[model samples]
Target: ILEEHAFVDELAEREIPVVPASRIDGRTLHSFAGYRFSVFPRRGGRAPELGDSATLEWIGRFIGRIHAVGALTPFQHRPALNPQTFGRDPFDYLRNHGFLPPELAATWASVVEQALEGVARCYERAGELPLLRLHGDCHGGNVLWTPDGPHFVDFDDSRMGPAVQDLWMLLSGERQEMVGQMADVLAGYEDFCDFHPRQLYLVEALRTLRLIHYSAWLAMRWDDPAFPAAFPWFNTQRYWQDRILELREQVALMDEPPLWPV
Candidate 1:
């Protein structure tokens, strides 16, 4: 929590369109009954209309600034979003924890294995890109859009990783559509930050890792009672089937050419 608070403040200092943390009686964190809490000033806005090209470009400018600041220093305490954490560890846990439905277990494993291998190939092709602090989960949900611009929130998922990790989520639709979206985003992103073209290879790979890691995240929380109730759709045979199909798609996509900046 402290790390997240500090990170938000750091980003805010750079004039990034982020909601800053609010200190409680001059302290950003408070502890009571062995629990910790922090507060942030409420910011009002709707989720950005990602379908709008002007919106994507506007978001790209702020993200570019965020990345420029992020690249200046490394995160000291946060985890790195990499194959080990988001891929292998999650796969191992889910496999060993009996989360997979019996009928789909083998198929799920096979698909995930192939997906991870594809992730590896993408990484190898990218070849040791710089890792920096990133807004780890940067979908439109985390951004608030107003006529002025976008404001990023939820630094809890901040981590060390390639800048593209903050990018790929902005893309959607088919390959050509995503390529166009990438061009629109980079139209503003490059104004402030120098983007690595090679990181493009890791987009689908990162997406693959996120998909695998998400299931494990839910499984690890299954015992909380709330998890099972909230995610009843999870751990079902149908869920595993969809996951298998999703991973297969990712594997193929990762093998395809990256978004070559339009």
Candidate 2:
């Protein structure tokens, strides 16, 4: 909670117009009373859209500034592979859920191991770069369109780590090759931070591993008939296999190290 306050305060100090936010230590996040400041817009206003090129450009610039701030101040948290809701060491959390069988568990471990090996390679090629604070989770969902332009919310996952950590999630899912659109995002980010292509791929692999792991966890919990299938083990298993094959193909090309520092 203190970290949230520090992050918001830092932004505010820099004259960035963010949604007024704060944390009431050990208090519920749902309560307005817990917030330290109040800066809101009209009630029932439509949420801003964040898809157009103009918005993307502004966001790119915004992220570049964010990277600059990060370089000035070391991050306060660790690089994490899972979301707060999943708890640390998500693999253990999954095993306890009674959904994953031995076969699935083995598959997940194998994928994670491969990604870790790739991370080692990334570090070797990129050398040690600047460690900066980051959003830690920067998917499309967290961005908002506002009168002032794109406003980002949900800093709960904010932490100190590689800039690539932010890029990895942005590049995932349907936006995998939306690199042209994402150039704006990178443009915003590079204003403050920089990373090698190898670093980017390594971080992306880690993010992918987390998704594959979590999908398995969701399958374990929602695997039922009466409840309606959210994603049963059978279907998720096939999807997981397909993704693994895709990653294998990607890593196969990485056999010759990527052109780093791009």
Candidate 3:
């Protein structure tokens, strides 16, 4: 939580549109009863409409602004979003715990291995990336659109990673549709920070990693009462089957040429 506060403070210093932790008697975090609490004022705004071209472009501009600041420095303690952390470590945990259904374990393992190989290929193509501090989980839900513009919330997932870590989640729909969306986003994004076309290679690769990481997260949290109640489908045969299917699709998608902005 302290790391989140520091990163948000950094963005706030640059005048980025973001929600910052409110100071309580000059202390950003207050410790009480063996727990830490942060005070953030309730700000009003609705979830963004990604389908709207104007909104997409507008949101893209602010993301670009955030990246411009993000590129200026590195996080002191946050982990980098990478295959090892997002892919290998999580998979190891799930496998050791026997999270997969016995009958489908081999099938899921095979698909995950293939997906990781594809992720590797994509990374190789991307080469060495220009890593920077990132919003880490910059999906539309985190972006609240007000009359002035969008204000990003939830720095808890913030980490050091490529700029595309923030940009890719904004894209949606079929391949052709995503291409058009990328054009709209980059139109505004390029206004602030320079973007590398090669980073496109990580688009599907990163999505695959998120999939693996999400399943692991769900399994890891299963001991918590909320997880079982909320994600009842998890650990079921149908869930594993669906995940296997998704990874199969991701393997194919990662092989396709990246959606480079025109």
Q: What is the per-residue lDDT of model 2 for residues 53-140, given as tens digits with 9 covering 90 to 100?
A: 5666676676666666766776455444432323234545555565444566567556645654554555565666566777766666
Model 2 lDDT on a 0 to 1 scale:
0.55
Task: Please give, for residues 73-189, the per-residue lDDT of candidate 1 as tens digits.
Answer: 787888899999999999999999998888888988989999899999999999989988898999999999887889998888899999999989998898889988988999999
TM-score of each: 0.96, 0.65, 0.96
Between candidates 1 and 2, the one scoring higher on TM-score is 1
Clashes of each: 0, 7, 0
Alpha carbon lDDT at 154, candidate 2: 67
After superposition on all C-alphas, the RMSD of every candidate to the true structure, in Å, is: 1.5, 6.0, 1.5
**Alpha-carbon error at 177 in model 2, in Å?**
4.9
lDDT of 3 at 43: 81
* Candidate 2: residue 144 Cα off by (Å): 0.3
